[model samples]
Target: MRELAKVQGCLDRARGGLGAVLVVSGEAGIGKSRLLREAARHASDSGFAVHVGAAEQMTQTRPFGPWLDALEITPSSRDEDLRSVAVLLRAAILASAGELGSATHVVIEDLVDLVERLAAEVPRMIVIEDLQWADDATVLTARAVARSAAHLRVLLVVSHRTGGLPAIGRRLRRELLDLDVATDLPLAELDHAAAQGLAEELAGDAMWPAVHPQVEAARGNPLLIELLVAAGGRSGEGDLRCALREHVRDRTWALGDDGIRTLQYAALLGQRFSPDLLAEVLGRPPVEVASALQRAIEQQLLISSGHDLAFRHDLIRDTLGEELPQAVRASMHATIGRTLARTGARSPEIARHAALGAPRGDREALELLRRAAVEYRRLAPAVTVDLLTRAESLADERLPDQVELELLWALAATGRTGSCIERAERRLQDQPQPATAAAVHACLGLIRQRTNDLDGARTEFDTAVALAAEAGQIPAAYLADAAST
Candidate 1:
């Protein structure tokens, strides 16, 4: 309620031509979206033009996805300057994926232009939710929009998890606050009184004492409080996660075979997904998928989110996904990964499925991970290391282990030479065969040289050439060129 008041204050300021950026951040199930929606409703009621959108983990590879969601009703302006905005929107819709380039900057600039132009016409509130999963381009655009919103007649609101933000997302938060043009709203756990009151409201009775134990168990998370209270006479259960899973299963049991199968399969897609996309993955008609999803809606398991359906809470989807047996989960992940690949989803999104779904030593999965690592190398430092690490775990002791070399390079590039050295030693111990070890040494030498350890690097390079010649592999000199990457 206090956060809502603060956000509403920003709206009032925007109405007076003094807009500001508000960054809302909190842990999972902490009512961040709920608060945002409440403020948005208030703005709408007060005659402020409002637009809303959110990002999802499954579609993080799509460019400007959240902006696309927020501006759903855009591009109808007959103003000549707005034509470029419409053109950019159409291009984004047509392109399934995008790389880091000047074209992306054009789109971001046009988007800011559109917002500034429209705000000049009327006061506005633009809220982008779940920014933690936003693609690189979306995060960049958020920065641009925030800078423009500082003095325009538009209040820009963005929410992300307390710890899940990408590098750019964090930077935006810090930069705006440092400039004194933004408000940081970090929502902590609710106090006892508020938690008990929320429990009483959810239960619709005047009995906070009866629900006090549930409140304590949920630790002030609104979603968990509701779940625990609705769990129906299971107050004695201690293992909340297991109990919650069983509760979900009990609810889904009535959905019958088709509905249960649909939910389990959809869980692999992400926190939010379009029924049309799910249908394609299942190789079923849209109507069939609709029927199953409709059943979920009836069960209060999934809620409509624009053109997509999202599980009522992330835990529900995660529970269903975890309920699958190990082999079944892996098979489903494999199926989803392969289907996404054949259907032209970008590497970053597909690589997640490949890492979880593909069988051991699946070279195709490794290749996908490698490509994804390359895509993220310059864009996101953390993701590059993560993807390459996953690839290395799946790689066998092949002579030319590109996964290992790439992982070391990424670790080194990110100033993580300690990890680089450790992993290189492990590679040498595990895959000491001439071709692989020689490559690892060559890569380590390059890192050492970068760090200005000239004598040490020279020694390592000499050892690499000797190993290459001993194995009769690619020319010893070639190892330097190959591994330097």
Candidate 2:
């Protein structure tokens, strides 16, 4: 609602002979398009001439597709200058052959000039939706139009997803960002109360307690919520996944095979992935990956996010993951993990994929999981638990005794002291090496501290210190200091 007010303000500014550009940006299905439609209706009611066009994924390869769809110049213009510019633009589009560079320049120039001339006659509003999918030439022409109409009575409105744009789309977004005369309107998902209200309205009298889970799962995405409501609130978790998959399929049906394959691989690499990483995973060239990404962006299946591509929605990624067969999914994950490991990616990222894809008792996966657990120990103790648990699952006689001790320590850090104590006591009963015994005592001490048993903690710490000192290990000093603290 506040965003609509902002667009209305931009429209009011345009009425005063000052042209403006308004960029409506958000993730897919978050209401950017709906906001533009509302702006168009308001412009029409205010006696402003409005023209609307949407960029299509299927047509993005065609040059100047969005511009050709949005503008219509009739020869009945009263102004001679307007008519001349319009004629030139039409001629350029209809041209059979010409110098490519020269013809493109002329088309861009005339299109901007034509819009300025028309605006001088009457206030005008132009709305282009899904600008992220617009062809490069169309985006360039739109930029030219925005610059030329800056001081005229024209309002330029464009909507795009916040990220996952091609290079040219990114350039257009940068140009808009630098515009002093433009307004940036970013939309966010509705809050729970607003989402509930919308769901109730959509569900009518069919609203039920069962609908709450669907709403929660939608996570404020209006389109997903609408779909759930349309299903008469019968959506369970599996139903929700299917619904999201169908939603993504409907949008991506026009993508070619290459684009679909690119998406499938990208999904495996997670919601955000780089072209280089995807290329490595698919064993394709970077150029091929870039082209496929471009097609996917044009189709609105992905958006450009900085140096990476992100799914238009997290649900889309989940949906894709759900659709993959178990074996294929595991294979892709294994390949991705190996690639990430080769590229020296972060331990946690590599471990996550490896844990899912690598065979049980895989030494490499086990080591990566343990290292990842250490990495997450302080930053996210719960994550440490998960990683260590995975490592424990893979651990065998091949794994060193210290790894099991490390897992118990990690579990203790997460306040699972009872489990840690039990595991440590059982291991200690086996008369392990001095260092191993010290580690067990240290782990139990930490758990005792967590449970407010200071005396017990001190006793364990003292025993740990004596064992480590007897082994001539520096860890005793650290354990002694830990108990003092």
Candidate 3:
């Protein structure tokens, strides 16, 4: 929320032309309001007349609730009579800055229509906060108004959480394509030094050591940090489960199914996930998924990194994971793995899910491990080593002989290349199946010959030639010529 550079940049842009729409998005309690409050102060100091309107969840459905609140109006009277209140609200804004007949800056906090209407009058900085819970009507109206403010000296700044407000964000972006500026501020996790400093700032010196892990665990989210500090002043975990549960419960009811699904799937992915992968996992269209992702990014539930995205707080992922049934999670993982496989892409992540989702004796599990081993062999050398290690551990004793040889091939191609000679030699010693053993020795011979192990290479080649004669295969004969070098 306190991305000073972004706020200042918007201010500068607004000063030059029709106001700028600065969308401040992050997760809940990420200091969105605090940042706006500071920007308001800065705007005031710079001699810009500023009026603020904040959008609260309760009054989102009622048109201009935050706008009405900012002006200290009770809409109870208007609701009873069904009177048009737009004129009155406009009059009030004009009275605040217009009556003075001076260069005024209007800061409309929550709703966009009020800001859009005021844009016609003068240079203004309109800040709409808590947009994640904004009413659909309010969002649509704001989007229309935001688009019209291009020629006016108005800076529209809206803040919402990324996960909670997908539908509204989607509508807003499609309708107001040109004027919208989306800014995602992923709060930086506190480093040791910063954690100690924050601890000292909130609680005195002695508390730093006690609270370091909690701060680290919270991932330096200012809102979470403040909440944790206020709860116990740098003590123990201090009801992390209770706090997290309450946090989710507080926000979940307001968001629709898309929000819930995005959060749950992201939780399964650990912290960060690829956008394409997330879309595939959800089985949603790219545009729709992207819109949801952008909304989540804006709300602070997720952050973007080039093409990948992640949860704003690690605790969010942890909490969602803990709350779900194991079976449900396994099902989701299976969907994710199959989706990835269809695209001809493989990941350790997919393997993990496939491993968990497939039944113990299931052929799908066997195939997933085999595919994972081969893919790991092709893509990630270090990761292949880890996956192969896990696969070998889980592999049944009755695994086919060829499967064992494939595992050896993967091992040789990955981190344990030094063990290749021993492994291949042992497999050959066991079966001495000429052509197959020759193939293994041929690979070993190539590697040995490359490393200048001439004697070892000679022995491997001689064995391969003898195997070629015994096997009487055209392929083995060719391999014999290649291995004999």
Ten-residue stretch with the least lDDT total in model 1: 231-240
C-alpha-based local distance difference test score of model 1: 0.78
The candidate that achieves the highest TM-score relative to the unseen native structure? 2
Task: Give the alpha carbon lDDT tens digit for every residue of 1-485 in model 3.
Answer: 34788777777766676466776665577666777889888776755557666677566555555445443445444442112354454555467653412211222333344454554455577666776666554465466557656766677666766455556665674454454443444444456677657755875566655655567766656767765665555334656566766776565544467777777887887687887777777878778788666655654566777778887678777777777788888777777777767776656766777766655555665677666766665566556556655565656654455555555555555536577677776777778567777667766766667688899877877776677677885545445434343
Q: Number of backbone collisions per candidate, in order? A: 0, 6, 19
Question: Ten-residue segment with the worst summed lDDT in candidate 3?
Answer: 100-109
TM-score of each: 0.49, 0.60, 0.56
Give per-residue lDDT, candidate 1, residue 128.
86
Give the poorly placed runs of model 2, Cα more than 4 Å off: 73-99, 232-242, 250-314, 325-327, 330-485
Model 1, stretches more than 4 Å misplaced?
1-196, 200-247, 250-254, 362-364, 395-400, 425-438, 461-485
| Candidate 3: C-alpha lDDT | 0.63
Q: Candidate 1, residues 1-485: lDDT per residue as tens digits? A: 68888987888888888777888988666889999888889998888889898988568877787887787634665566656666665665567354547678888888898898889988889988988778878888888988777688988888987756657878877876765558889988778888888788776654445556657656667767877666533543444567678767755765788889889989989889889878888999999889778767655468789989998667678788988898899888877887788888877788989889877788888888888888777677578898887876777655146666767767877879889899898888885778778878887787788789999899888888888888897654555454444
Clash count in backbone of candidate 1: 0
Higher TM-score: candidate 1 or 3?
3
Model 3 TM-score (2 dp): 0.56
Task: Look at candidate 2 and tell me the lDDT of residue 240.
Answer: 62
